[model samples]
Target chain A: MDFFKRQLPTLLVLVLGLGMIIQYYIPTTFSQQVLKNVNLWIQIIAAFTLCIGITSLLRTHYTKIRLQHSGWAYSIILYIVFIAMVILGFYRGIQEGTPFRWLFDYVQTPLSSTTFSLTAFFICSAAYRAFRARTMEATIMLIAAIIVMIGRIPFGDMLSAYLPSFIPGFNDMAGWIFNTPGMAARRAILLGISLGGIATSLRIILGIERSYQGKD
Target chain B: MGIIQKVLNVDRRVIYLIVFLAVAIPIIFPLNLPVTLTEEVMGVYNEIENLPEGSPILIAVDYEPSSSPELNPMTRAILKHCFKKNLRVVTTTIWPTDGSGGSIADKLVEEEARIAGKIRGKDFVNLGFKTGSYAVVIGMGEDFKKTFPKDFNGNVLDKLEILNGTHSNGNSESSLPNAAFSQDARAKKINSLKDFSYMVCIHDDSSVFTWITYGYERYGIKIGTGCTAVMAPGNYPSLQAKQITGIIGGLKGASEYEKLMNYRGEGARGMDSQSVIHVFIIILIFLGNLTYFILERKKTVRG
Candidate 1:
């Protein structure tokens, strides 16, 4: 059982990972064919994973309701909505003008949009409460944020006209900050992430990483 | 208490109420704010503009309804441009669909197609809700037909003439009304990620990374992006690196695009409100810092 669960997955990963890496460099028809098949398999397996994920979510929420956890009412609501959506989806096939589509249009979109829209209010409050220039670094950050905020809107363009021709305008200065310092930092971070990802991938492919099986 | 103390102790509700007013007032009274174009936005516009009519371009609507307010405008503007230029559009969503109104992508795409008088399976197609994110991308890079056997409406991809657009000129196989001769027969032989003239992923999240990493890096496909304002900064590195063609960022970016197209849509209309809120936030930040500094100065004097 240990070998089947542990060794099998590791071996599969090793073979698949090495194969993908090798085929990435190879431009032949056979390599292309392998890549196509592997991608299809990934999609299929991902579909199965989605099923598993839904099942796990249902089980966890069901248990939470059973135990009458602090947020048990929310769990019950979740259960009701989940089941309703599933039933509607299967019954009406999610086509346009269907009951499923109606729920999506009226219920889900509004709820999500309302929730996301509230961020504007919260951000306003947070900026008022937290944005203070106590130190040089904080002041610099504050100035940059202000410039970028102005640049993000058309008002920045209007404001830019008022500034002297020699000095960079709000939008131009903001773009510079974003492209220069911002790009440099983001590039460094992305390079670090890529290197780290490659190392982890190598470890998994070499069978040196078995943490996914709940044993390192 | 003191004025400084009162300023410092201003209620959070007050901030919210003020922001609400700032945003709501603009909506109630139209400002018709002038939108300036950024190079990032202009890059995307120019690329589509320069492409010959009937050129196939992939557009991935990889955002949710929450992002609809911002992202939908970009998608709509791009669609208008593509359809107007007579570009054959192929759309797909790699985002999790089937739950929580994922078909909004389909609805939006179909609406644009309908308005443009473009027929499905010929001028446009939506290969909706594919499961795998990066894997689907890679699969498309290799073979679009194998990746999506059927379109969103369950029509066989084999029957979709839009995918079989000419490599030389990008015209469909059936361009003429009563086709005497179809010289674009080359399209029948080759269809993949690289075959499309360009691809723009209108996304709210990090899916552009997958497109850039796998789709562009591996397949050599040209990619542009219409991303949320916040995400635009994150993608600039990729832009500077020349991985993507251009970026349409946030509502402002969308409005710039709408302006470029000489259309006044939701994006153009919303600029007044968007600008108001941005200026409002900046003012709030400034006022907060001013009160803090004054309070600090007073404390120093007392010491």
Candidate 2:
């Protein structure tokens, strides 16, 4: 029973992971067919996993509501919204001109947009405090940020028109910063992330990463 | 207790008020400042312009409503350009949250197609939101129909006349010019990722990485990206690697695209407000630094 619960999953992972890697190299019809079938299986599994996610969410909220936890009202509201959306989705369908579509467009979209727009206010306040030039590094960062901010917009181009022709304009300097130093830093980070991903993937395939298997 | 210290320690609410006014006033009174096209924005435009009329292009709308303000303009502009050039468009969304992202695409495509006098299933098709993210993208490379049997509207892929000349057979033989091409010689059938003339992803998040890795690196499909300004700098690596052909970054990029298209849209109008907020932030930064330095000098002199 223990083997069927834990070891079998890890064994399946190893076999499937190795099969996928090997399939990528072999161009035969059989290999291609295997890959196609595997992709179809993945899609099917993903659809099932979505159902599991919804059930988990419902369970969490239901427990919170039943226990009368602090802010349980919010949980109730979430349940109401969730059930209402699902019911509407099924009743009128999710197509355009449907009630579900109208709710998504008018209610969900505006709420999400409002939430996102609040970041600008927060960012402004945060920047005021954080961009202080207490050190040389801070000064350089502040200046670079200022240049990039100005250069990315139309005002920078207008300012460039009046400046002396010999000196590099804000737009030009910002472009250089983005292309050279910015590109270098981003590439280094990307390389690190890619290497880390590969290592983690390999660990999972080799059964060294058993965290995903959960405590048995 | 001095003015410099007071200025340095001003309440955050004051700062917020200033920012709010900075953005609001610009909307009421337009700046009409000239927007120069960046090489990055132009790169995307030029690539789309270079494609032959009726060539199939895939657009991945990988953003939710939160990013709609920034990404929607780019989507609208690109759709307009594609339809204007008489290209066939195939759009899908990887976003699965309430499926609003797919709906956004449908709404925009419908409006743009109506304006362009293009018919659905003929000039464009919305495959809608498909699950399995990278898996579905990779699957499309092998056999697109296998991954998406039917579009968002429940129309099967085989029956879509717009997909007629595409690689339906999953063989190299389908690459040959269709004999029936004379009827609609402009529209080419798209069978795989490589079959599309170009692929553009207008995203607010990290799905562009999946497209680049799976769609471009694996299948050799030329890809461009349109991203929110916040996510744009992160894409510089992909741009430098030539993994992506070009990028339209944020409202500014959208405005530049609009200028190229000679269509003034929300992106252009938003720039006036964006410019003001940026300048306001810069001024605040400068004032903060100036006050800090002044207080530091005063402290040294007193000592």
Candidate 3:
């Protein structure tokens, strides 16, 4: 039973994979119907999963509030927000005419915007606190960043105007760095990542990786 | 000693205020930065451009509210290109969270379609959010509607005149009458990548290749992507292999796309702020290193 349980998902996946591969040659009517059923099942599972996530969130917070932890005060605030938002969302609607629109537009949007905006601050602090010109490599990175920064702004043009004309397109050099060098570097990384993904998928298919199944 | 300590230790709020000012000043006063289009972004443009007009295209809006700032511009840029070429578009989302609700992708597509004078249920159709991870995508390849029962507005997809040519009353393989075709007959015949021209994945997540392999791979459909700067490099090989036609990574990619299309949108406006903050970070780094060096040298001399 343990062995079957362990290999069940793997076996099912193989069967599904075979079905998918063979569906290509079958009549569109038959293939499309099978595809449709699979899609509906997925939607059903997704709906249930959303509930699971919400329940997990509530369970963790309720447990915190129940135990009266040191940070229980914060948990209270979170619960209030979560419950209030859910009530507003479902009771009314997210349409512009509804009161929930205020919750969505003012609260949720701003919170998210503010969180995203913090990346700028964190990046700045990280750049400063962590950046050390300790080696030639560090120096090069610093200079490249500076050049890219300047190149991206209008100031780069003003600076380049004062310099010699020998450096053609120096004003737009940063744009070129982003377009060419940055893109080339990025492409090389993406290719490696894709290959890694393919390998991982193959491992799952071949059952070489069982970590996805819980360890005994 | 006290004075030195006071000078070194500043409140965190002060730093925040200064950074806020640094970013705000640039935005309030626009800087028409000299921007040149990168090949990566231009490649995205060229991919859409090369496609014959009225070609069907699948656009996966696989992001939620959290990633709107990055993915929105990418979507807008691609939409502008597609609409300009009169390409038939089918938009959908993967994430179930807020997927049924007011998703950013849903709002964007509606707003763009309105502005571009594209008719809904005709020019473009939003299949809304489908659940099931890779399963939803794979199912779409086999039978488009089995995954999406209704469009965003609760209309049966099979009933839509736009799908008349592609999906039959009885089956997906059977063609509908020419009179039933919405605006473009050819667009209706597109059941998969073999039917559509290309696909563009505008997402914040890294699982774009999963769709490429599952959906596009079988049909020989070309795939391209737009993602955050951090997610950009990971797609380079796909871009290199020509599996993905091109990529627009982050705000910079959006900016480049905006420039190439000659339509100044959010990417152009955001460029000033992005550039300014980057410069401020560089200055902070310089100051930090200088402080560290000076303090270390003094300690060394005293010892």
Candidate 4:
């Protein structure tokens, strides 16, 4: 039972991981077929996993409701909406001109848009609190942010048009910041992330990372 | 309380109100500020323009409703361009079809195709939302039909005249359509991701990187992307790396694409509002800092 629970899974991962690495280099028809089949299996499994996820979410909320947890009313609302949406989806399908489509177009879309739009308000308040130039680094960050913000808009170009010729344009300065310093910083981060991903992948393949196997 | 204290402790609701007014006033009125096209946006325009007519182009719409406001205009503009150029479009969404993203793509494609007087399944097809994001992309590179056997409408690919030569049972080596004899061009079938002349991915998240890595890196396909303003900066490294051919970033980028198309749309109209909000936020930042410094100075003096 221990072997079935642990050793078998690890063995499968080791074999599949090595096979995938090998398949990338050798592009033979057999290797290509293996990759194709594996991808198809992933798609099928992903579809099933989505259902599992939905079930897990429902179960979690249901437990909260049953236990009468604080803010349990929100769970009720979630259940109501979830059931409504699922029924609508199954009943009419997602085709054009259905109640399902109408619910999505009207309720879900506006709710989502409103939620996302609220971030602008919060960002405004947050920036007001955060952009104070208390230190040299903060001041530099504030200045660069201001420049990039102004330069991205059409008003900046209009303002630049009225400015003197000797001074560089807001757009030009902004472009320089983005192209040189921004790109360099981003590439450095990407390189670090890539190296980290490689290291982690190797650990997972070698079964050194057993976190995904869950607690004993 | 002193003026500095009042300014420093201004109600957040007031800030929200001010932002709302700033965004709303410009939209209600008219500024019609001229938007200068950036090189990145122009790159996307030029690539689509330069593609031969009747060439198949894959468009992956990978954003949900929250980002629809920013990404929808881009999707519409790109579709309009593809149809205007007489290119074949195959659209799929990595985001769930049961969600609003799939419907948005379907409606936008239908609207644009109707405007262009293009026929369904011939000029354009929506393969709808598929599960397995990166895996789906990689699978499409190997075998397109295996990735999507049926489109959103449940129509079989084998029956679609647009995908005539794409079937395994048919002539596999036909050349793509040319402008002169496009009607009879038997070669305009897309069997895999490599078969497409170009690919566009309009997303609100980091899924564009997936397309770059899986679709472009693996198959050597040229790809362009559109992302929300917040996600745009993250794409700069990939853009500099030339992993992506071009980018249309946020509503601003959408407006640029509209300007290049010579068709004024919602994106162009929203620029004035966007400009006003940005300036308003900058002003708030300045005022906040000014008050903070004044208070600090007063405290130091008292000490």
Best by lDDT: 2
Query: Candidate 4 — which pairs collide?
Result: B175-B187
Interface RMSD of each: 1.4, 1.2, 3.4, 1.2
Tell me which of candidates 2 and 4 scores higher on lDDT: 2
lDDT of 1 by residue, B1-303 (tens): 898889888988888888888878887887998888889999999988877566788888888888887788889999989877777788888888423424876777789888988887777888888788899988888888888898877789987777766333234454433233323332433368888778999898889999999889988889999998889989998898899989999888999999999987888777888888888888889888888888889999999
TM-score of 2: 0.93
TM-score of chain B of each: 0.90, 0.90, 0.87, 0.92
Better of 1 and 3 by DockQ: 1
lDDT string for model 4 (B126-167, tens) is 888888888989988999887889988779976887776431
How does candidate 1 score on lDDT? 0.83
Task: Provide the lowest-lDDT 10-residue window in model 1 chain A.
Answer: A207-216
* Candidate 1 stretches greater than 4 Å from native: B97-102, B166-190
Q: What is the interface RMSD of candidate 4, in Å?
A: 1.2
lDDT of 3 by residue, A51-166 (tens): 89889988898999999988988989999988887887678755445666566656666677678778777777677677888899998777777886676555566678887777
DockQ of candidate 3 against the true complex: 0.38
Ranking by lDDT: 2, 4, 1, 3
lDDT at position B269, candidate 3: 71
Minimum summed lDDT over a 10-residue window in model 1 chain B is located at: B177-186
- Model 4, A55: alpha-carbon shift in Å? 1.8
What's the distance in Å from true for residue A7, model 1? 2.4
Please report how far candidate 2 places residue B146 from its true position, in Å: 2.0
